[model samples]
Target: MNKLNNYKDNEYEYYPICINGQIFNCFSSMSLKDLLLYLNFNLSLVIVEYNKQIIDKEDWSNICLNINDSVEVITITGGG
Candidate 1:
């Protein structure tokens, strides 16, 4: 596993990842769960696709994100 400190840019390090086809920069190493929280997602109401695979909710905390990794998040909404 690569440490968060592995990347540096004039005193800052950023990990670039793709979420829902958009690029985002994140600092420090974090799990999918953390990412969801950072994005203000309600865990119980969302589904996550990691690297083109549907990820089990139980595995969110164990899946560490990598640079350039692709993720897709879908929020479940109620409709009449």
Candidate 2:
């Protein structure tokens, strides 16, 4: 597990998370869907694994990110 600086805001909180082996300070109140959008990911072309488990699209919005959470994003590609 990683350590994050505790932060607070009127609307949301901020914390650190590990994404694809990189550490990033992110909003603690953000859902997976929100995080993806914040990172400018093309939602339709990628798959997400949270805490080592594959997450379904429909559950993205329901999963809230917390400090030190692990996330992995895989982009889909096609080649002839």
Give the top-scoring candidate (TM-score): 2
Per-residue lDDT of 6-57 in model 1, one digit per residue for the tens? 3667866778788898877776577999999999999999999999999999
lDDT of 2: 0.90
In candidate 2, what are the lDDT values of residues 1-80, reduced to their tens digit? 65767577798678889999998878777899999999999999999999999999999999999888999999999999
Question: What does candidate 2 score on TM?
Answer: 0.87
How many steric clashes does model 2 contain? 0
Best-matching candidate per lDDT? 2
Tell me how many residue pairs clash in candidate 1. Answer: 0
Give the lDDT of residue 45 in candidate 1: 99
Give me the runs in candidate 1 sitting further than 4 Å from their true place. Answer: 1-12
